[model samples]
Target: MDRLTAETKIAELTKRIERHNRLYYEEDRPEISDQEYDQLVRDLQELEAKFPDLAKEDSPTRRVGGQPLPFFEKVVHKTPMLSLGNAFSEEDLRDFDRRVRQAVGNQTVRYVGELKIDGLAVSLRYDNGVFVQGATRGDGTTGEDITQNLRTIRSIPLRLTRPVSLEVRGEAYMSKGAFERLNKEREEKGEALFANPRNSAAGSLRQLDPKIAASRQLDTFIYGIGELQGETVESHSEGLALLEELGFAVNPERRVFDNIDDVIAFIASWTEKRPSLPYEIDGMVIKVDSYAQQEELGFTAKSPRWAIAYKFPAEEAVTVLEGIEVSVGRTGAVTPTALLKPVSLAGTTVKRASLHNEDIIREKGLLIGDHVVVKKAGDIIPEIIAVLPERRTGDETPFSMPTHCPECGSELVRLEDEVALRCINPMCPALIREGMIHFVSRTAMNIDGLGEKVVAQLFNDGIIHSVADLYYLHQQRDVLLGMERMGEKSVDNLLAAIEASKQNSLERVLFGLGIRLVGAKAARVIAEHFGTMDAIMQASEEEFTQIDEIGPKMAASLVNYFAQPQAKAVIERLKAAGVNMEYKGLRVEAGEDLPFAGKTIVLTGTLSQMSRQEAEEAIARLGGKVTGSVSKKTDLVIAGEKAGSKLEKAEKLGVAVMDEAGFLQVLEGNG
Candidate 1:
């Protein structure tokens, strides 16, 4: 066929494919089977490959993803992404309606009520119809670059039907069914479970490996348009229509109401009806129907005055905690667990709830035989609500804190107001094993292919008691190779990954330490504050508390941790082994010209370039903080491919937004 004829054929195929994409993703109706869609995609790929010079950026094949990213840099949004103020009750909804009316002069308007998805928020940027980048809603101003990761999400279009440079905002969520399956997989593999669907979505999105993120099978729904370079829409509804036309998956449940009463009724209906759907809805977002009214209402420091989130009642279930039993952690923290007689909750079987500490057990007057109420706090973790003494039997035994670590028989010590007993025994075998496990965890040392079984085998063989011991394992290469299921190639790969881990950021090192109450976020804070092991050791408790999120308890823990002779020795050995315990050697993403520079960022979705750790470092290099969640304090949110609830929160907070290429441009100062 001649060039003109081929071009004509290509245009026709593109339109057909776009229609199919609309049917499958946007409409949830697949006119063709998966096999047929693949054929269409393949045909487009062949045409594009055959005519590389003529291949349009906006061709349907662009969404398939490009080469893996070297690292997600940082993106700055042209406009600040903002959040919506939330209303928990009918009265609060009325107040929101009144505020809007007062701001817009009560024109008697329509409103858009959308389900508040429990997922990460993402911003997609396209240039001339080609999917260019994706990012998380970091702080309203900046987000980690995740263009490559977003490409892996099959639902998101990589290329558009027509040439246009646009930014679209959407929610990337892990459905309830997916969350349950993921948690089940984790449980079967003896990994810690995600507390809820939101966390599952979050955890999946933040995967440093795009392949891993893709395997998690994330889904998304486009809710709003951000900065559109071409075309025009007068109302938010029109924008939604345009998105649908462009092969975007807009939420089907959205309703437009003419009055607040109708809006209230809609919210009321969804509050009960939402659970019947596949996804989880925390609330209903009420937005002014008229774009004109939205602009007039403007925004507050953290939220948009034109919009408010009316929260639905949380899914709750009441179950009796029959007794409290102590379970030992890998770190030797004896968590007192409330034993419930196997009640169904949160779509799964709930046998127990974590009591957190001996203090909580005591505070609740939790007895061994007491009938106590249990609830999933935040609809995430099962928590002991209160002890029902009235339901307690005379045979109930008074709960007492353990004097020794149950796992390794180490002495348990009490920290004031901590109600939890800590095993300060650094040499405890269980502690060592668990610490080693954490050391190789993805968010920490990130040693691939080294699982619990391998770690246990190493421990049992007296081959890997300490993290440093892992470094020397290559010396035992022959022995390692001879082990069960271990081949020469596998051993070499494991050794290579271990060797590479020595260069991870100081935050990872701190988290891998498994200090009581010190989490991944806290670890980053400490690494930034102290800069070095020596400096952290010398810091006073008062100094420690000055850092954000470091409370009195955390400060005390840090101080006590440094004071431990074993911890000091371990740090020395770790340093000797080339561990990165200071930030001096790290590279932060240089978003020097980006609007989100000197901002905080949180990444969700599989980032294309580098690992999640590397992307975070990239953000930091650009003078931004990479955080784990979205909040009012965030300045910009660079939403990536499969961004979930964090994206919504970023929008609700009225923060700035950006996609990957935009983030890179801002980082590179071209945007």
Candidate 2:
């Protein structure tokens, strides 16, 4: 291509890459798959290399992508945390091996290979063997200090075996099991679910509350070092050993090889065994073991010269889009799933793939009989990635989302600003079953022995129809024991769990009801505000809107839900069954003499003693309004460590500033 064409392409690529970087790094929501994103970066790099004169110093390819989140304190690394170049094929790995050999004067190089975990990268610093601070890889030079959240990960050691000051790098991740359980809980609570385990882990770690992080079962694996003091480790494998000795969790599957052939073989073997692992591994990272060899290999502008990630090809299989099937979720959202011709993908039989929604089907131009490209998303969810229009026959039938609920025949409505079509009928059988499942979920009602499988079995057998029926199961103990997988001990345990759920806080009951737009947080807030189930049921939309976080939409949802006879009947049955619905959680009501009375406050950066949520709650109790962003209306800006642009903006606006100690003093009415 000519220089002008290259220049235009470079500008386009730069804009696209920056957008993707913001989505993937800052937002933790990526539009494209990692492989597709890599291809884009590769294209940009090739163009820049061909036309060096058009290349900009601030190109996305030249620097780390993320920036520190404003919620946490900023941490500057002693050594830059650089990303690695990717190797997609065997030939790519061979080329990488050739470069390493050539750069190191044709010397035999020993390499260490570790699984590339699909999770957030973090840096943990230790001072005198005591874990001091932990931070996210927000760009390479700077990060968000999340020490409190990092401490919650049981795998991360608080103190090392030796009193040595060092900085170590690792990947913080949620196991697939943990992710599934979390998602199940979220679904039950009427919350938007995370896409994958990686997203779940990243979101969990980035939470402003350490308590929230602690609730999520997060794990970590230390792979390398950033900087070390009083330590002598010559090779990558040796460094991992030292980290493991210091009580850090290290991946046991890592192998050391003298040649690239063995590394390639090891990578190949994982393709079949990948699904068996408990966590997610998107690829394999190969690094030259010797520190001396690594130094000699030098570095690229963005990646280390000694390391390359061999990304496994996303497993894809072509299958016929046999039919479109619609299912109603707990929230009554009608989701269209693609019923595909059975095919093998990623070592599993793939009979169905997610079509997502009507927009996707229309965008992909998919038809009932069209040949579609199917792939497992994160090697778990089967999804139709694309359609082969050329392979489409004239007999292919186009599909559309249903106009009415398939289960209850209720008129479906598409909410404003949402692509999903939802059924509004509260008594729909599918909705009732889903609601019953949610009511007994671990987080909602804490019914230990009653899982989704058991809930389905009970629902299918017509033994339990609603949440209230679960509470009355004691009378049907004999019938429960007659069911499959139900013994005397199990039935007794389940009944005991159901009875115990009756005494839970009103928030749990509110969440268990599966009201639209009412998640766990909202349920807690609303429950606290109303104090009783009756109060909430009788609350007007205007009263609901007066609450701290409730808006008109949520207020309307609550009013409409309570107005339903079906929901009201269930609540009556639950109440009749002796279920408690009064808010039992701690609440500090606002007082006239409170220090923060009638003040609007904004919190910036990380608070050491309390989480962002706790601070906000405290402020609210003192009759303070906590608003996002700094403005002239903001009465005070509580600045903590590494206060960012909000602090500066508050200063510019002449808003009063208070440190953590001062804020605590104000909370105690001693300021």
Candidate 3:
């Protein structure tokens, strides 16, 4: 095609792609599949590559994010981001309404009640329809510029529908489903899990690498406007409407109430229905709808007098600890659960709560038959927070850690570094069963139709002894079909899923192995370094330690794990079954003219351009070695936001200290 034709085609593709982005992100209604959208993007990219000079800076491709800033620049809000005073009860809400009415001289009024999403508050700025900046609500005065990271949130429009300048306030939040998925993935990787959706959303947005933020699938609700040009709204509700029209996501659950009684009713309704929502809501934000009335009410030194947050009461219940149940995980760690007298807590009936470990049980002085305060941790998982010593009867039994595995009768031992008592027997039936379950989990091999029930049935019936046995199940199709609840079609689907898992990356296989201390992140690191299961199996402790994130303990664990005859046999069987054992990700061989190639690079402090994980992965892809510490042997130290002792140490050691800008330059092969 000619350059003119290509240019016209690119424009058409950009328009269509932007519209689709709006439909999918802003409206939450996608007409086209992901594959179709990707094809359009690819077409535009191809055209842009062909007609390079015709490309525009504000092109849709910019949303993909190639510009990486080293650190976030500070942004001073044009208007101070004020906090809202909180009301804990209906009386408090009434008092707030009374004060507002008094200030407005008992004029006719309306209040907008919105669900207070538990998330990070951020400000977005636009210049002539183009999104220019985004920042956190730091101290309500200044915040770190997170423009690039914000752009990755598809819900946040890159350009306004109208060519008008505006500044809006929003809450960037991760949905409950996304949060659960993220935490599950993190748990599988053996990384520290985020406590709640709020923290996860905050962390995801703060990631310097836009790609990291993009992968998190974050959404936002523009609640209020900081400033707007060429427009005027009489009330907060009208401003929200204008924001929605300008391609910003506004929470649809907000209600405008004519009376405080109605507003209180709205708050009460949400307190009960909050859990039903896809995201978490901590409270209801009640604001005077009239912009004139808000100005009249004015602001205090810290918060707005016009708005108040009615926080929901904590959901807690007193329940009797009937008994302690010990369960073994795939890692052989024995967890103690509190079997509680069924009590209604939060949105569900709680019959059990996680005691976590012996430390927790001892710390809370929890005893069987003792009354305990049970509450949902982060309003999700039921947990025993405290024991009421006064309610303990003489018949209460002191709970003790199990001396042996309940399932396999093997001796349980507590490792020096660990708090939980673990069953060390590799061949223990409980460990084997749990290992099989973990291997087929969503974050592991991801084999479908192999849930807890199916896995238990397979194990109890002696149909499968190890993870490798799953691959060979196709040969036993008739036998599987003959089992209760297992039809021909069900067996076929199960076999198909198992077969499909063979093509998974070596990282998944490594994680599925249930190696001690090997999480999803560690698995990926080890797999990428070794490039194959055979290479990992042959690697020595010293070789394993050479990889970033792998330490002496982890190295020894991997070495000891691979040395096991049973483990090696399982891997061999899997290999024989045509299961892939090689890493399927990008590999950087020894001889590349990359700037980071063959260098021991240590990242210190917070990187503003990308997450530490993203940076490490990128460095590895460029054949660089990433380590946690700085030493004389360190070739380069990339110090980011708040460069601490590591930076000083790097300087003292005469190691090269590169700033974020320098790191970006090096990444571009300009170093």
1-671: candidate 3 lDDT, tens digit per residue: 99889888988998898899888876779999989988988888888998999788667776666554444455668677988897888999999988988766647989999999889999999999999889999757657788888887778888789998888999999998998898888899999977677878888776656878877879899999887667868789999999989898899999999999999888888888987999988888999998766755656767888999887886899989999999999999999988999998754568888888999988888778999888875466788877788876699989889799999999899889889999998888889999999999866887757889999889989989999999888888888988889986677767777877788789989999999989887998899878889989999999998886899999999999989999999999999999999998767764667777778988776677776666877787777877756678999998887666567778899999889998787677742
Model 2: lDDT equals 0.83
Candidate 1 local lDDT, 412-459, one digit each (tens)? 887666655778676777778878887887656667667788997999
lDDT of each: 0.73, 0.83, 0.84
Please give the distance, in angstroms, between residue 48's alpha carbon in candidate 2 and its true position after superposition: 66
Q: Let me know the TM-score candidate 3 reaches against the reference structure.
A: 0.53
Q: Which ranges of candidate 3 are over 4 A from the true structure?
A: 1-249, 252-314, 593-671
Give the poorly placed runs of model 2, Cα more than 4 Å off: 1-246, 250-280, 283-315, 331-333, 343-349, 356-363, 376-381, 393-426, 517-521, 547-551, 578-580, 583-592, 598-633, 637-652, 658-671
Candidate 1 vs candidate 3: which has greater lDDT? Answer: 3
lDDT of 2 at 163: 95
Q: 2 or 3: which has the higher TM-score? A: 2
TM-score of the candidate numbered 2? 0.54
Worst ten in a row by lDDT for model 2 = 62-71
Distance from true position, residue 329, model 2, in Å? 3.1
